[model samples]
Target: MADDSKSGGDLEKDQRSQEDAPPSSIYLISYPKIVFLYPTFLVAVVVAIFMSIAGESAQIGGNREHMAEVMSLIFLGVFGLNLTVLAFDFPRTTSLTLFFLGAALFMGAWMLLRFNPDIVPTITGLLKGLRPWANSQMYWLFASILGLIFIGVAISVRFDYWEVKGNELLHHHGFLSDLERFAAPNLKIDKEISDIFEYLLLRSGRLVLHPRNQPRAIVLDNVPFISRKEKQITRMLGALQVQVRPDNH
Candidate 1:
């Protein structure tokens, strides 16, 4: 009797523990492509800090001036590259590779011309005019504005997001906490990494969810850490299926 009672107590404790455990679910939040500009934002912040330090130092003539010019050039290059990426979609890795190759060839040609100034005196004069120059204060102002914009983006996303649970898919939206639920029993999910560059930036991709009885799939784009979320949803649904499967007679 005592052994049976102890076993019963152990079973009760196991059930209670299971009840207390957090749900195994994934929250899917889609972000805008501007979020990927974080690389440029980070670079700006770093440049601001470096320039501030350089400005404070006693040695502020030849080397300091050169370093500031280099920093400004780097900042402009990154900003231009970021804008170029935003303007176009590199859907395939081949396209991305081609872009890099083209950029490299252009840079190589420019460098060759720069070194052999006699060949194209006009080229050196044009390059001198193209040099981007900015002070430490300018860098700080740019970083501050970008940082605030990022914060706004973060806050705006909270109003609309999706949650995937063991037995259902949920869309939670609106300022008033509106939620729409769909059955997950026969849910179909497709993961598409459409843009190679975007994926490289944030491991982001599109998730197409085909919920049971729905005529159209719910397409969510710019989802960060997409692979992990897909695996998690798969595991949750697989486990749910196993739990509900009928035994052979």
Candidate 2:
């Protein structure tokens, strides 16, 4: 009876300690700075809005000539937004950004050729001075789609949060009430530095963890500053054993 009571008390104490532990400090392994990118994007948005208004006025006035300028401005705005996403460290962001950038460049080239036939002498000579009217509707349509994609990516990244606590890793993704937890206790962690560009740019690091009784390993890629993360994981694991650098490896 006495032994049972003593075991119960110890279990309660352990539970209390775990419950009382402080929350982990979340770290963004890699996030791009908004300072430089935001300004350029803002400028592009302003230009687009101005061009949109001007184009509408021109259409109302029956001029219809200023429509090309409006399309160019809208393209510029999309290009700027794409640049901003590229500035962010998101991998998929770059692909989408590049796609939009390429589309904008293609459209811009077409618009230039359409408005200024003399600029492309070969095409002008071949076509015999055929001019294409600017498609104002398509200009705003593509811009709106690109803008929505940009906003979606931004929101997704902003809401995703990841952190490491003592012997545990937590990820909170999505808008609200969505959480995922992963925990490993005093497990062996190995880090490998690969990629020549990663070494030069100092932006890539890999974390490999071998957990007990787990057939598969946990691998984290594109982690920044390996040494610091190694130390953090080391300290957290060491705390479990009440000793640093266990000889067992």
> For every model in order, what is the number of clashing pairs?
0, 0
Give stretches of model 2 more than 4 Å off: 1-23, 27-44, 56-67, 70-161, 171-181, 184-213, 217-249
Whole-model Cα lDDT per candidate?
0.85, 0.59
- Candidates in order, TM-scores: namely 0.84, 0.38
List CA RMSD, all candidates. Answer: 5.3, 13.5
What TM-score quantifies how close candidate 1 is to the native fold?
A: 0.84
Q: Candidate 2's residue-wise lDDT over 1-249, tens digit each?
A: 999999999999999988754345535353333322433444445555655666643542364445555445555665665564445443443555766788899899778877998898897686553333444455456556656765765676656755676665666677774876666575788887554334234444667767666688767665667666777667666666664445874
Give model 2's TM-score versus the native structure: 0.38
Against the true structure, candidate 1 has what lDDT? 0.85
Which parts of model 1 have CA positions greater than 4 angstroms off? 1-23, 56-65
- What lDDT does candidate 1 reach at residue 199? 84
lDDT digits (tens) for residues 1-249 of candidate 1: 999999999999999978754458789999988888888999999998998887623234653446667788899889988887788878785876888899899999888886887787787779766745677889889888989989998998899999988788989999998999999987899999978888888999999999999998899999999998898788778878888899997
